[model samples]
Target: MSIPAAFDYHPAQTVDEALSLLQQYGDDAKILAGGHSLIPAMKLRLAQPEHLVDIGRIQGLSYIKEEQDTIAIGALTTYTQIERSDLLQQYFPLMVECASIIADQQVRNRGTIGGSIAHADPAGDMPGVILALKGEIVVQGPGGKRTIAADDFILGAFETALEPDEIVIELRFARPPAHTGSAYQKLANQASHYAIVGSAVVLTLDANKTCTAASVVITGASMKTERSRAVEQALIGKQLDTATITDAASHAADELELVSDIHGSEEYRKQMASVIVRRTINSALERIS
Candidate 1:
């Protein structure tokens, strides 16, 4: 049986209490939210933090609200909540669509978006989608709160820009412009359900079906989720056609130093990157048309 190492558990009732515990424990402490990822690592001895500060009971941190031109989701919000939210479905269907396919129903009920993003696993699907949609991560610490763009939040595998004493508070996303559509496509490993190669695309088209803006992001094939500048450049000002998407998606791996693991070879992942990007782009275009 897999079992975790010895550790002191601190269940914080408020965000301030969580922050104070983190400050006291310093680097030896780990924040526990959903614990879907961290607990497994602990059992494997891959993570052996001396202290665990759990903030799952912090009230008012699991809401979804629309404010003017943006939607704000509390960090502790579960994947199940996002999947079931009528507001999220109406405004950002991409998020709801992606949430529906994450793991199984049980994991969805327990896994929080904040925990998933903070874990920063290379195979995570949300990071790529967030990058494509230009989401922001809001965090709070001893100095107060600040926001960082999705592109700058995840540094690498199992890493983030969050300071040791900081905790994620919420996620903010600007409402997409009119005539905009987005989609996420992924090839997943059968056992773990983690992405083998995933792509997310967001595009804004003018009346003539010419792309006014485009953002492409890919994951599971690199050290971190990365925006595809080459793909975006190829799509901007161009119509979404077979030839245009093919040309753009062909550059999916151009700027990435891809990951090679037992599940896939580097060359195989490179090929799938383009394939997923093309499919994702096609899906987004269909939604608007």
Candidate 2:
């Protein structure tokens, strides 16, 4: 399983270095953050970039910090680091849930947050999770820096709004307001280690024990991980009860074009989306209660 031959492997000590390489080589240049996705694609001859600009060596860019409003996570942060971060555990346990479900320990140790988002796989846990949390991506290019909302950034399967010269630097999101809680649940495929169905729910409750707002973003069950808008609209101002939960869950696949691989059928994934939506929402609601 050797990767295809490339002309150069440049370990960049900074984002400017990587951007310069990209500018020089244009389409033949590829930014390598963690190599979890690109390496596999290269092995299959699916990607043929002539130059790889490694960004993993950059320092001072792998931290989880809580600002006055939002929490900031560096792009180079590892899944294991996220899973073990005490600040994340207290402020955003849903991320820890995503970390635990991504893969086994070895993959988590090496797979980076930036690489996962850049790969933009429809079945990725964090992309769908960050969507639910309304995360924002901070990217830098030759011109300067720009921030894109999570919902707007992920365009489709293996696609994002990023330009060729852009490099993701960090992710940011406001901490879920008090009384808000979240959870992530996934059903993974055996061989590919991709999710057949993954759902992350972030529930914001009011003082009266009612759902003030919610987001249910599911992946692997569709062409791309998408927000269950019908479900979210159904939960607003509703009491977090079993009967209401059931009703909301019924709308899980209201307008989805699910993907069917050897792992499962369209009908099966749709059915499971409803189930995971119910379970994940309930689990998150429990935390808030």
Candidate 3:
């Protein structure tokens, strides 16, 4: 299908150039990173940006760096890059776990981290996974750079806290504490490239085999990927036992207003959320057990 005839395209070779175009076009222009999200939106006539500032050709933005306390992944890092990164595999296996289930090989080859976050699809997997780890997104705009917590950064489905002139630089996450393990599980729709529901669980176990801390973030619900505080509260300070897992999973939908489409109804999604939460928690506990 062809895009709307009224649209204009602007290819950019530098971040500065993209920012300049964004500033010039204001709400009339949309930034195009991988074109995975925007192209489809344009085709559906859901969005009609007068101009698109393309940043796909920009270089030196894709990298995975392991530092003293955290890992920094550049914005343009593709799902394939993340799924194949040995450094990520060694330290952040849950990220690789999530990345591997994203779409298919072809979409993974071109879709990017920044594009994913900025697209802010409520059903996207990375939002919940990164939120569970309490990651930060570094963004640069006319005012220079600043870091925003993942929770606060994603405002809603298909929306973010980014200004028109700003672009996400990278994502930073703390290295998992020793003996800690994590997992991501999702019920994906067939051939649609969207997660019906995705849950990321991070677990920390003490020397005596107790659950010291836990972060459970779930996406594809009513809101953007947000920590299930109720679930985390139930698990923290307890042993990662079957009883605890069952109890915590029940709290996964404490106050959420689930949305429904062709995939499921609100009630059906609520049930799946409980199932995915339990599965993620159990799967992660097994690794460190």
Candidate 4:
């Protein structure tokens, strides 16, 4: 890969300072968190920002804590941190599972959740998990801070709703209801460990083993992470059994704008989506209390 184009670096210790720098530089600046994604893109000349506002030094932006009814995660929290977090293990084990399988140890230690989501790679594992869990992304800009639902935050490949002057600060996930369980399943590329196709599911069950609510999201098969509304609609209010799950999972790729590439053809990805979705939902059901 070619060396990254020359760029100026500014280290910001506070969120306000970061926002100010972003405003000053506008679209010419890129926020650097762990640099796992940004640096690679820069080296490949896919991105050539003139200024990099390094926010790794920013405090209060790398924590995992419960706030009121939500589990709040700082944007700069690395994948390794999520993989090892006791709190996340207890409350959102699917996130832990997802984190554990991302890339490899070295990448996980340096890849921030915010950077991954903001990069919005089609094969990224985080976006589907967050969408399934109904998380919110909190961002700060020149005006003020605001929260965007995960469903609306990620727009497409390498795209998000963030303004040029905004930086992601936090991610918030509401505590799941009792008897809720979640799972993530991926068909990983052997070389890079990026998902060829992945699915995430969250299911809330009643005492009778009926699914009260369901969220099914798939990534890597498409240009962006997307909820499988047809699959969800087929599960809610129904008793989850092998037959039901099989039927619902058949819709995993419904309406999805699947991408065809060297990793897999569109048809191959569509077929695998159903298989992974089934496995993910079954795994989630087994975890329900």
- The per-model lDDT (C-alpha) reads 0.91, 0.89, 0.87, 0.93
lDDT of 2: 0.89
Which residue pairs show backbone clashes in model 4? none
**Higher-lDDT candidate of 1 and 3:** 1
lDDT of 2 by residue, 41-68 (tens): 8888888889988999999779999889
Clashes of each: 0, 0, 0, 0
For model 4, what is the error of residue 158's alpha carbon versus the real structure, in angstroms, after optimal superposition? 1.4
Alpha carbon lDDT at 217, candidate 3: 88
Question: Which segments of model 4 are wrong by more than 4 Å?
Answer: none
By TM-score rank, best first, the candidates go: 1, 4, 2, 3
In model 2, pairs of residues that clash are none
Cα error of candidate 4 at position 95, Å:
0.6
Model 1 lDDT per residue over 1-289, tens place: 3788899999999999999999999999999999989999999988999999998989999999999999999999999999999998887888898888888898899899888888888888777777788999999999999999998998988888999999999999999888988898899999988899998889999999999999999989998888999999999999889999999999999998899999999999999999999999999998884
Worst 10 residues of 3 by lDDT: 1-10
Candidate 2 Cα misplacement greater than 4 A, ranges: none
Which lDDT value does model 2 have at 266? 90
TM-score of 2: 0.97
Report the backbone clash tally of model 4. Answer: 0
Candidate 1: misplaced stretches above 4 Å? none
